[model samples]
Structures are given as structure tokens and as C-alpha cells.
Target: MRKTEKIFEVKDFPYPHVIVKDFLDESTLDLVIDALAGLEYDFKESDLFSYWASIELTDIDHPAINILRDDLGDEVWRKKVAKAFGSKSLSSIDMAAYVYGLGDFLLPHDDQVEERIIAYSLHLTPEITEEMGGSLQIFDVDNNNSKLIDSIIPEYNSLIMFEVSKHSWHQVGEILQDIQRLTVTGWYHG
Candidate 1:
């Protein structure tokens, strides 16, 4: 048997996963929010102006997505994620932005694809409260166990990365009143 030298260690989150936080600086986060907020007037009224950004999927070469990967690929973020996965290979990387009055709620589902992906959600909201109901539920499909990962009454800049697979069935609770669920989520491609 070959003895493997493990540098990164994957975590067993409630849904059989792992996570990494605080991948961006406050100033950078501010800049991103500013850029994202500028698009409000351009979008339709139904889109509701709040604040959020997402890593473009279809346009694999989108400029904004390039920026996200450039920023996130920084040594700091990479090292942290490497330590978590106990490996350096990441399959999916994306960013999403959300602000006040986001109407839709993410329903329970698993990320199924031929290629496995690691799910990631970065936090930019300055504050989040339990009643806001933006918590994420990760179900242990195998054991039927579950975990409610609450969003922090967040600070300036924080990121959450996780190992998500087909079994990673998850959902987002509803947002109460008029609030935001500002976050970025994506999966690895490898």
C-alpha cells in the first residue's frame, strides 16, 4: 500500500462536506458591491435593485468571471481551499451576488453532472439575522442527517467554500420581509 502525504484535509460537514471562509478583503468586497450595484438601473424592475454578482457559467470567458477567478485564485484563497480538500484540484468556481428583495428561494437539490464539482458561496452582507431566514440546509443523504448552516450577521468580507457532489442535496430558507441574501455560489469543473 502506498502511504499518501496528505496536505489538505476535506471536512465532514453536516452534509458530508467541508468549508473555507474569509477569502476576500473588505475593500475588494466594497469595490465588487459598487460595480454590481451600478447595473441596477439597466436591469428590469422585476430584477429588483439590491446587490450581488455571480460567476458567469455559459460565457466561460466572461470578463467579470475572469475577475472573480483572478481575485479568488490569489494565494491566500487557494492555500486555504487546498488545506480543506487536502488536494489542489478544484473543479468548479463561480460567484453570485444578491441584495434586498430577492424574490426566489433556492429549493432542495443536488448538483448532478458527469464531472464532480465543489460548491462555494462567499458572504458579503454586512449583517444577517436568523429571522431573515437565509440559512442553508445540507442534508446527509446517506444517513438522513442534516445541518442548518446559518449565515453570520456578516462582516465586510467573508467567503464559504464546500465540497458538493450529487449527494450534496441542499436548500436555502426563505428571505423574510425586505432583506438580502447576498452570496456567490459555484462548483468545480474537475
Candidate 2:
């Protein structure tokens, strides 16, 4: 079934967030999933079905949808993301993929890195039941000074957009089932 579009600009959200109307077309997402199914990464061991993923853009011929290579970084998404982050300009963008486990979870941390990064995650895993438990938890660094970022669940063919910099603390919740969570993690440049 096709995933219906949902309201991304919720008034309850503290941080500036915006979900792309058509971030990834179904064909593109499907292609990504197919590529992922045949990928091989011998990194560290994950407690759950989760796996740490990092692929170079050159590996894939699809410039429209790629990861890690500098060529796939489009200005359109960068500009939009920069505005959301309240930044003047965007220096670069990087793409990566995540395959989290059903019971895998990450600690609360910020995406504050070398550049002003606006992050966006596109879910590709189909039929994600609530039991999957791989939700992206974003904290509000302002209002809840102590803590409070929204925990957005991983819905099929959906996008969760946010600004990433030195202060954005976010994490992925654990999945409690035997399903694989796939996502396209985009990072913007300063």
C-alpha cells in the first residue's frame, strides 16, 4: 500500500522541521532497498539486526539517489535544509544509509559535526509494524533545556527532516522485533 502524506509542520514541535513532499519516489526507494539487500559490510557486530552502513556514491550509477559521494549532493535540498537551520549558506551535503536492528537503539547525542548539517531520513522498509521500535528521537535543545526531542517512528516511504549541526541531539530507538529498518540519512554542509 502507498503511504499517505502526513502533516510535517506540527505546531507541537519545538525545533524547526519540515518533511519533503516528494523526497524519494517509490521507484527510487525500491531501487535503494534492492541495492541494500545485496550490500556487504564487515564492520562491527550489532547486538540487534542493526548494521553500521557507509557507502561511497561512486558505487551506484544513480546520481539521483546515492550515498557518501560528493556528486549526489543537490543544492535544492541543501538550500531548503539550510533555511530550516537558520543558516546563511550550505557548504556541502553527504548521504549515508542506516539499517538498524529490531532491538537496536542509540544513545542521545547531537549531530554537531565539522559542518552545519541539516539531516533528513527517508524510510524504505515496507510493512513496518509498531513492534519494529526503530524510531528517530529528536530532542529540543531550547525549550526543554534539560531534554525533550520528539520520537518520530519509522513509517514506510516517509521522510523525517531536521537541521543538523553541533547541537542537534538525536538518536534511534531500539527495535524489538525481527525486522530490518532501512533509512537514507542525508547530512547538509555548512
Candidate 3:
């Protein structure tokens, strides 16, 4: 179950972002992860990204996915997330599970799409290491020059969220080892 009193601390610099650790209780997270593992994913690739992703979670007919979608779409949860980012509304959300195996990566780009106010990634991997190389990289761009500023390891059960803007540049680093960087990600729309 989602925590009712969970506090969202929005941070400035490199664009507005927030990271909530252990967003889901241990048992609930484990169940969600197990449910995700049971779903089928299709390999998707392009110049910008490469990974295996499932269909939208909302459209899935599974118990865990339904629970996750319902919780994320809850009025209280939506309001809390929206208020944290100073957003007017999180009336809708789009979610999907992603699996990044060895050699998979996503190039840098801001998630600027129609009405997407907040972008989020919920990491579900049981374990990870620096050498595995599936880290989320945040970039800083000034005067048309881009520089890598931060590389965040995919810590288990952590949820990362950021406001989608022209400057919210980020990417998923290539997976170097035999590890699956699994995450449920999407956007909260206004």
C-alpha cells in the first residue's frame, strides 16, 4: 500500500526533481516486482533508446498492475505529487515496465511532451552494482554545451521523479554486466 504520510521533498538544480526511497512497503514492492516479471515485454529500439518494455500498465489485466495503477491514480496520491512539483493537476498518468539488459541504453533527451508535468521511474531490481552500468545520468546544458553532471545508481525500491521541461536532460547509461535494470516508468500529466 502507498504511504499516506510520505513527504515529497522537491529539489532544485539540474531541474526540479525528487527521489523517494522505499516508496512502496517491502512486501508490496516484492509482489509488484513479481507481477512485473510475469508480464511479457517487447523489444523497443531507436536512435534515442533501447529496451524491452511492456504495454501500458493501466491496460494490463493483472492484479498487481491494477493495484499499482489504482494507487498511483488515487486522488490523494495525485494531489500530493502535484503539490510537491507545484503542478495544477495530475489528472492522468501513463505507466509501463521496462527492462534494460546488457548493452541497453537511452540517449540524452528531455521528456518534453504534451501535458507531461512530472516524469517518474520506479526501480524494482533486487540488487545492483556500480560496475553493472545501468545508472541514470543527468546532464547539465548551458549555452548549447552539455555535460554529464550526475550518475545515479539504480537503487532497489527507489522512485525518482522530475519535472519534464526543455532542460530536464537525462539518460539511462548502458548496462555493461549481465544485469536487468527493471523499472516501472511514466509521466504524470496535467
Highest TM-score among the candidates is held by which one?
3
Per-residue CA lDDT of model 3 for 4-123, tens digit only, reads 347467887788888888778777777798899898999999999999999889887787787788666678888888889888888888999999999999999999999999999988
| Per-model TM-score versus the true fold | 0.67, 0.74, 0.95
The sequence of per-residue lDDT tens digits that candidate 1 reaches over residues 1-190 is: 0011222345565544544345555555566666555443212223322223443533455454355566665455555565566555653444445543444455667767655546666555667766776666666565555554433333335444456565677766566757766665565545
Quick one: ranking by TM-score, best first? 3, 2, 1
lDDT of each: 0.52, 0.61, 0.87
Q: CA lDDT of 160 in candidate 3?
A: 87
Model 2 C-alpha lDDT per residue in residues 79-105, reported as the tens digit of each score: 555555566688776566777765566
Ranking by lDDT: 3, 2, 1
Measured by C-alpha RMSD in angstroms, how accurate is candidate 2? 4.6
List ranges where model 1 is wrong by over 4 Å. Answer: 1-10, 40-67, 74-83, 98-103, 143-156
**Runs in model 3 lying further than 4 Å from the true structure:** none
Q: List the RMSD of every prediction in angstroms.
A: 7.2, 4.6, 1.3
